[model samples]
Each structure stands twice: as structure tokens, then as C-alpha cells.
Target: MTLPLRILMPLLFWALGLAHAVAAEPSGKVLRVLAWPGYADPEVLQGFSQRTGARVELTVVGSDEAMRQRLLSGRGRDFDVFALNTAELQQYIDQGIARPIELQRVPNTRRQRPRFRELSAIPGLIRRVDGLTQVYGVPYTYSEMGLIYDRRQLSAPPDSLQVLWDPRWRGKVLAYAGGTHNFSLAALALGWQQPFELGERQWAPAVDKLVALRRNVLGFYSLPEESVQLFMRHKVALMYANYGLQQLHLLKAAGVDVGYVIPREGALAWLDCWAISSSTGDPELAHAWINFMLEEPASSLLVSRQGLANTVSDSVASAPQVPLRWLEPVESEERREHYWARIHSGDSPSRVLQR
Candidate 1:
């Protein structure tokens, strides 16, 4: 239960007064930030706190599922701001877990590249709520989910998504464990153009493809760090690089001789954005954090240290020049998750289709 402002004010002032001598006095505001690993660096958080006089509390989530669970578990009250991909932003908007961003408060967005400046041009960033169309997310970073292969095992880089299931490399491949994305990847491998929208007829085949993928892979991994550990420990020949260049940078740092490529079918890419939580008590501080992330040092650090492309600057790293299928809202996220669980749990194809 929230205390009345009259009582809360006196308590807050008393607490801050007691600590002012030992620590730099803060503005009595705290900004809670929940984001993926590497998105909020220590230096960046320190800079934001120092500049704004707001205390920062950060939480790092590794997978999309984990992020969703956190946001929903607390009804968006756990954090004031969060980062999620464009593909996943719509559900939050529809559920009212995310609130419309006040762009006027986030002035740094003006410094973003032209493509990101016009939020409406990109899909899933806005929606009409009660006759009012409002913007909900701001683009921050992006990357393509390409394939990473070991140069020592394959003479040349594999050109297609089908290579993930090649019998010859059975038990030598590492794939992502996400449900919706794995289903979409399976759709692509089956030569379906609309990977996100699977028809009734497309469901069985996608299930079969995922079952095959489960059988052929060394194992499935959810986080980039876990994937790298599995890849190096198993001497994995090929991997579905769900984390894209970020994974590549980790492996390269560990001196792994690997090559990254976009398959012939095209790679799935995601543009992650920072969004304000609907339950936030301090919307201004949340907006300040979002704008602070767009500064040169923070944006450049993403490219140099995390190997991700920032919205404000051109990346120094080499991203492949190939067609990319940016992720979109899937037809049925729940259906995909239900089936993916059975498939990943070692269920036989016939048994998996029983439902």
C-alpha cells in the first residue's frame, strides 16, 4: 500500500537528511531500470546518476521470456523503464503495461538517425487507445540473428538455414531455445515466406521441423553466455546465432575461430527499444534515462563493447550486406510457446501433434 504524500514526504526527507553527510545528496528520486545484459553498463548508470542526481537501480534479464515474466509478474510496477524488441512491444501496448512516451521529454531522440526519428513509420511503435494514437517505444539498438559457424569444422560457411538440420552435423549444432523464435526459424527453414503467420496447414510441418532441430542439435541454449560455453565445450560446428554480433564478439574475445553469416533465406533481425512502464511514479526520470542512453558515450559503447548497432551512430563493425527479415508480431505467440515446450522436452513428433 502506498502512503499518503503528506506522510511519505516527511519520511523521505528525514531519511535523506540522515545520509547526506556520508553520501552525495540525491534529488530523492530513484529510477528503476530493467534491461538486457550489456544494455546498462556500470559507467553509463553512474553517469546518469551523477548528471541527474537520481539514484539508479538496475536489473539485467537474459532472455525474452524472462523479461516478459518479470514485467507481467509485477504488473509493470517492478521497474520504471525496460527494453524490449519492436516485435514484442504490441502486447504491452494492448495490455496497457506500457504507457505512451512523451517525446518532448526525451530530447535526445531528435539526435537519432532519420529512420528512427519518425516513430510511426515503423510498425508496432504506436496504437490508437481510446481514440488517441500515442507512441510507446523508442528505438535504441538492433542486430540480426545470423548463423555462427566454426571455421575449423566447415571448409566454407553454410549458406542456408537448412544446414542446422544436416544429418552430418547432428549433435554438433547449438540452437536458441526460445519458443516463438524457434517456430519462426523452423518456418523459414521449411521455405515458408510468412514465418510469423503460420496457417493451420503450416503448423504440423513447423512442429516437425522443430522436432528435427531438437534431435540434431548438441543442445539448446537461452543466453549468449550459455551458448558460448556450450559451443566451446562441445566443439560445436554450427550455431544459430540468436544474439547475433554480440555472441560473435564474445567468441572472438575467447579466441574462437568462427565466421558469422546470414543464411540464404534471410536472417531475422530485431530493433530493441526503451519503453516507460505504466506503473512508474516518476515519468520524468524514466524519460531522462531514455534520453541519457542516446548520448555519444553510451551509444558508442554499445558498438565498441557490446557489438550492437546503436540508433544514433553507424557501427564500426562489419555487418553483412544481405536482405534481413525484421521481426514482426506473430500470429499466435501462445500457441507457439505451447508446442515449443513439448518439442524441446524430447516429445516424439506423433505425440507432439496429438493436440
Candidate 2:
């Protein structure tokens, strides 16, 4: 079946089950979740069910847009918990699809890093309203956008972002095709200060630089899994990637010679958070799932095995290659908005190639 059909079929069945469950006698059980890939491994859910007797069922979402649309469609009422990137959390909160998390119910909330907590507490981060202290989401895993290169091909990894512009490597480099982050990376490589916080004037320079790099790019990938495969097959020598550890592990398992690096210029850091759906009837089950994730064993598994850094303090120490400072809170909203708007305005893939 086609990809869209594959997704829609399961979703339709889920909707039917939800309607039947809601109308029939309420069971005060079954914790449904909408999560990203690898977020709800069978073992993880089994452990939660064993301890709480709340059977956990999960639906995996491919992107932030998919998650938002599912929630907006009122299908979110079927799930007790949802995972979303910090960038898109505010929209869910504003739409009332997600509600403020009840901290007292989640004891493990205290285990999170101070910086993670502070960022989660920031009103505008999860809600557009001003001066609201309501905490709507619990920060889970953190990631950064960086370069993954085949060490066997290039004796040493490129130290600066400018290497992407090198003609010798033309048609051998891969980049994320349709995102502000890639554009921001290009701008940084071209010596634009704080590319993520660009102004209208900076947009032209960033776009010009991206067009130059596009000339050299072998291909553009939208999915992380596909990018990882490209590296393994040697279809591309270098790629802009997220989850450095995860990608490295996959490549190593496939016997691909690869390594990841943060450029001399910093990269963009992103956090994913767990939020309870306002429409959920079983708050306790949702709370249990959140606490289960924050526990040391699970947190460590997430970090060491999945290569994602958990916000909570646990058995998992920071990975050797990832810097702790990059996990710092994002820049102020004003700066982020300016940069986001500037980069997005110049994000036409066709325009990028024309230049």
C-alpha cells in the first residue's frame, strides 16, 4: 500500500476504537499515547503496564505537523499523552489540545536539570499568552543539528561550516531540503552572525549562500532514516543530521565509516517534551507513563541506547562527543521569531537551486 494509505488505515481503526471506548462503559484504564518513533518501545510500555496495570497503546507520528493535525482533529481525545517538539508545543497549548501538567502528580519532575525546567517553565515556549506561569509540558530528550561525515572519505572532518561550499566536495554533500535550520546552517557557514536570529537584511545573504551550497549538494533528504541510509550506502559523503549518536550507531552497525561533528559555529538545539492531552479521562495513567520515562533506568536507556539526551538526571551521563553547553535554553523569542521569519521567507527549494 502507499504510505498515505498505510497511515490513514490505522488511524481510521484507532478512531473507531476511540468512539466505542468513550461511549461504552468507561474502564478507567488503558493509556493511549501519540509518540515519535522509538519513543514507545514495547519493553517500555510493558514495564509501565506491569507496574500500574494501565495497558499502554501508542501511535507513532512522523512529524510535528502530523502530530498537530491529529490533535486538532479531536483524535487527541483518544490518547492520554502526546509528544511534541518544544518549537510546536505552544500551538497545542493555545489550541487547548494540551493542558498544564500537574507537577504534584509527577514526582520525577524534580529530577530534571534546572535549565530544562527553566526552559519548560518559560510561558511563551509552550503558550503564546504573556505572563502565564502554567507548565504544560515536561522536557524529555534534547538534540542538536550537526554534520555527519564519512571519516574514511575525508581524512579529517570539516572543521568549519564553509566546507559545504567547497567545489571539490560538490555533489557529494547532503542537506535537509526544506527547513529553516538548514538555511540557518548555510548562513552561519557564510559568516552571518547568529544565523538563527537573522534580520530581514540578513535573509538575502543567507539565501545567496544557500543557493551556492545547493549547487554542490548531491541530494536533499527530508527524513532522518533516509539520510542515515544514504550515509551507509555511501550515496552521500556528508550530511546535515540530528541525533549524532543515534546516526553514528546505525552507521557503525551497518559497517559504514562515519563520524559526526558540530561545526566551529554552534548548531541549533531542540528539545522534545511530553504533554498530557486535556481530553484524556485517565490522568493518573498519563502521569505514570511520564514518571516511568523519567526514572533512571528508562532515562539511561533513552540516552545510551537511543542517543538522545534526557533532561532528567539519571544513570546516563553526558555522551563524550556532545557538549553540555549546547543543551542550553534557546535564545529569546524575539530573536527566534526574527530569525525564523527571515529564513522561512527564503526557504524555496527551487529558488535555492536557481541561485
Candidate 3:
């Protein structure tokens, strides 16, 4: 007494359709994202998800170049959001990979700090061949290269970059090996005028100084976690690191004794921003996530947990230690290019490996 085949098939189809109708409904849904290690933590994502029912998938990337390669490989749309440093965004905008952000749709945009808005939304920051203005990114955090040292190893922290080459500190210092950010900051401490605006003539002396320092370096580290680990293990006494607050918090939590100092010459500041992929299919979801991140509560959590400044104004009240001026817009491309070329010449062997 089984039911007829046609009737059973139709009933089964109806049941399946009903089940899909119930399951496909989403309160909030987000796609994958690429970001730096400490930029977003599990609790931060959980808070957003709990509030909006949106699920966030995060992929940690170490460098801007790695993010670029991932996006350019034709799967850019796989992620609804990605984080890029301001310098990296310049290249992304030039390549037409980043889509313009419509702040009007995200009301929380008003919550962002004035400096963050001024830097990211500035008209000429990312110029295009067309006359249209493209605001393609939103800054999340700002960092400056500084010295991270072991309080137990050094009675007094070095005051300037020159100590990197001192015979006493030789084989006890570490630095970033991949980019010119740390090197450029070090050059500034060495009396290089206009540290971020070097010319060919200005580079020779900088290279010589860097080469000498490289000779004395314990090793070059490519990742912050590794850098911290080295310090924890007493592998090196001092290293060039991003703003100390974040690392300092982690080290303290791990029961490691460390301290950070901003050299007298000042430091090279960098801003990391979030941008939607031009290829993203779910723009609404992406916009929602960005807006969610800008909300006061979420922003506060980000600052308190990660030691990164939220881009919005309200976030600043909780993160007063983050210097607002560091978010200032970079100089013209011509000037940046001049410095970029000199610092990235690839001619010096010392630049290849920090001995």
C-alpha cells in the first residue's frame, strides 16, 4: 500500500522546499576577511555576531604583499572585507581592485575620529584617471615603529637608532627584514633629514649606516609574534616593533618583562584600513560589517582588547593613548615615490639579510 511514485516525489519536493525556506533565512551573514594578526580577535567577532547575527570568517595575513597576492589571484570576492595599510591601499586603488565606500549608507561613519575620516576620505589620496572621487577605505588602527626591549637585559633603553650599531648592543638587536618602514625609522634616528623623503644621494649614507647595523643585528624577524617570542626567550634584547601598547599587553599577560620606547627622532607611523573588494557580490553585508565595527561599543572593545585605536571619534575617548596626528595623510605621491625608491633599491646585500 505504498503511495504512487508521482505523488511521493511531489510531496518530498515540497518538504525539501519548506526546509530550505526556513534554513536560508539569515539575520546577518558575512563572508571571509583578511586582516593582520591582532587587528581582530575572536571576542570582537563574537560580539558583532551576537548583536547582528552576522558570522565573520577571518584570515590572518602578515604583510600587505601577502594580502595583495591573495586578492589578485582571482578569488578576491571570496572575502567581503580586507585590511590594508594606507600605503598598500594606494596600490590597490591604482589597480582598481578596491571599491569606493559609500559612507552615507553607513551612518556609523559619523562616529569615526575626525583624523581617520580626513585621511581616508581625502579627495586626492587615491587619484584616478577619471574625475570622480573614490573613497575606498576606512582606517581601523594606527601604528608607529618603535623600540621593543627587555627591561631585565638593558638597565636603560637606548635613546636613538644609533645604538643599533654600537659595539655594546651588537648581536643583541633585531629589526624588520621585509620592508623599509623600520629601516626608514631607524634612518630618521640616525640624523637623516626628511626620513620619508629621501633621494638617491641621500640613500648612500643611509645604506652604509644600515649595513653596519645589519652586521651587528642578532637576526631579522618577519612577524610580530615571532619577534615577541624571540624577546621572551631572551634571543635578543631590543627590536624595531610597531606601537608598544599591543605587544606590551600581550607580553605582560604572558608574564614576560618588556618595555617599549619611542626614539627621540620620532617614528614612522602607519594606518591600517578596511576596504571592500570591488568583486564582492554582497555589498550590503560588507557595508553592515563596516558599520558595525564603527559602533561605539564595538569600537571600544576593539581598543581595549587589541590596543588598536578605533577609527571613530567615540572610540578615541577610550583610546586616548593613540596619537591622532599619526593618522595625518601622507605627502604627495611624487615625494613618497622618491623615498620608496631610495629605501627599496635592493642593491645592498645588507638589505637582503640582517646578519
Candidate 4:
């Protein structure tokens, strides 16, 4: 039974298309990662891909919130693991997007500093099920969000978070555009011991402080390189280092004469860690990836090149009086985000807090 020429040709093409698509499907396993830029170095990914049979596919994001939103967009099925700050990891845990880590599988974590090895001591890393504890994230790197000032512009280092509000720095200051850190910095300047735990009464004042900072600054920056560019172009006298010492490293490498200060109120610090996705098909491979990153060479790249402190470092900046206020999960993430939006829209202080 010979078919007509036109129908036979169409049927043959459809069968061939299906065969080609199936053949093009990848054979090797893949370890998908959602991480920050430096965490996805080309050489690191290539080496990881070569070491393990699994290919490494990394998606780089700019901020914690950006990473969170990306994970939510895919409903945890997109990446096998994530590199996120501890403060932001909670949302993923709460949403069941992240899974508890098996410490037995990641023995390299034992090489971490004493402080990092005690995950249960930390506020957010542990959970209990039937009286057995589980760990969620593995602390990888950290930095303190401090103040960076041009030594040439000022003779002495600014000692207070209030310096950001100082009218003296008007038109000469650069700030991070994010709402979270800015609000926290405002709360710190207002002497709130728990800056993230802002009460309704404290909200108005914090909004007012942030509005002041917004009005006085030349512009807000998002990236470390953007801060360097802003400093060079606008003669930015002072900057809130959102990327912490990483920004300072970039600025210094660019030949900027800037000094970093912790201020009297202390700097807000962040601890970024590796977390596994609950929906991942290969938990052991994900664990292997985390263990690989904990190797000495990875820490060396972080400390020597990126100016970030890793978990295994012995001589990290740990002075007792440095007063570093590690960032925590805030009282109401939604409220802070809502109010901070108004602050950025050039709203008057009174109207910004009206809601």
C-alpha cells in the first residue's frame, strides 16, 4: 500500500524530527547551581565539571532577594543548590524549597573554623524532626558591611553610622540602592539594639532617616564596580559598602585612596552559605559540590582575590571591639519592604510612613 507522495514525505519528516530531538538530549548528569558571580568562576566550574562526571550549570544573581525570587520563580526545581546569605535562607526553608544537609556526606565541613562547625549554635541553620536535629546551610564566606571613605576627602575616619546622615557629606555620598540594608543602617543610627526587629513606633523614625540619606546622596549604586565608577566620576566622598570589603578591594585595586571603618554603631555583616534544594534528584552530588568548594584552594581564592572571609581562615579580622552586628531575619520582611519602597520613591518622610 504505497501512500501519496505529499503524505509520505510529511510522515517521514515528523519521525526524523523526533529521532533528532531524542539524540540531542544530554547523557551526562548535571549539577545546577544558583550562585553569585564570583562563586561561578569559569575555572572553578570547568574544574568541578571535570572532577565529577556531572556537568556544572550555574546561574549568577546580584543580590539575596534576586536569588530568592529566581528560586521561587522555578519552584525549587531549577537548581540543585544555592549560595545565599543566612538571613535570606529562612524564606527558602520555610517554603520547603531547601532541604536539610547531611553533615556525614560533607566531611570537608569538619575543616571549617570552630564557630562555623557549630551549626546548632547558630539561630537559623538547625531544625528538629522527631528529636533529631538537621542542618540546612553550610557557611562558606562572609563580610561586614562597613563604611568606606576617601582618605583625601576626610582627615579622620567617620566613627558613627550617623555620618551617612551628616549634611557635610551632601552631594558627595554614594549608597547601596537596596532597601533592606539601608533601613537597617537607619535603624542602627537611631540606636535600635535590634535594628531588624523594628517596632511600629520605630518605623517612622527609620523611614525619616533613610529619606534623609536618599535626599543627600548623589546616587545609589548596586554593584561593586558601579561604586568604583561612581567614586571616580562623581568624587564620591563616602559610600556604604554593600559588598563590604569586596568593594573596598575593587576600589583599592582601581587606585582609590579609601579607608574602611566599622563605625561606633558597628557594621551589619552577612554570612553566605551553600544550601541544597529539596527537589534535587542528586543530593549526594550536591553534597560533593559543597565539599569541593570547602577545599583550601577555594578559600584562598576568596581571601586573597575577593577580600571575603571564608569558613577555614585562621587570621580573619576578629578584633573584640570591632562591633559587628550580623544581619538577622527581620521582624516583618514584608513591612520593611513595603515601607522601604516609599522611601526610594522620593516621598516625604511623613507620607512615606503613613501606611
TM-score of each: 0.79, 0.74, 0.69, 0.81
The regions of model 1 sitting more than 4 angstroms off are 1-25, 61-78, 129-132, 279-281, 316-323, 326-329, 341-348
Least accurate 10 contiguous residues by lDDT in model 2? 1-10
With candidate 3 superimposed using the best TM-score fit, by how many Å does residue 128's alpha carbon deviate from the native?
6.3
Tell me the spans in candidate 4 whose CA falls farther than 4 Å from its real position: 1-29, 49-51, 63-70, 314-323, 344-346
Candidate 2 per-residue C-alpha lDDT over 252-313 given as tens digits, one digit per residue, 9 for 90 to 100: 66777777777776665566778999988988778788888888566776665666667776
Per-candidate count of clashing residue pairs (backbone under 3 Å) = 0, 0, 4, 0
On a 0 to 1 TM-score scale, where does candidate 1 land against the true structure?
A: 0.79
Best by lDDT: 1
Off by over 4 Å in 2: 1-27, 120-132, 190-198, 232-235, 303-305, 313-355
lDDT of 4 by residue, 1-355 (tens): 0001101111233322221111112447788888765654555666666677677776656545566677899988988998887777888899999999998999998899887887876667878979999899998887778889999999998888778878988999998877777778888788888877877788888888888899888989876777789999999899988777787777888898989877778778878889999999999899999998998567777777667778887534443376666667777767777877888888898888775
lDDT over C-alpha atoms for residue 71 of model 4: 89
On lDDT, the stronger of 2 and 4 is 4
Cand. 2 Cα-lDDT = 0.63
User: Candidate 3, residue 114: CA error in Å?
Assistant: 4.0
Please list the C-alpha lDDT of all candidates, in the order they appear. 0.81, 0.63, 0.59, 0.76
209 Cα displacement, candidate 4 (Å): 2.3
Q: What's model 2's TM-score?
A: 0.74
Candidate 2's displacement at residue 161, Å, is 1.8
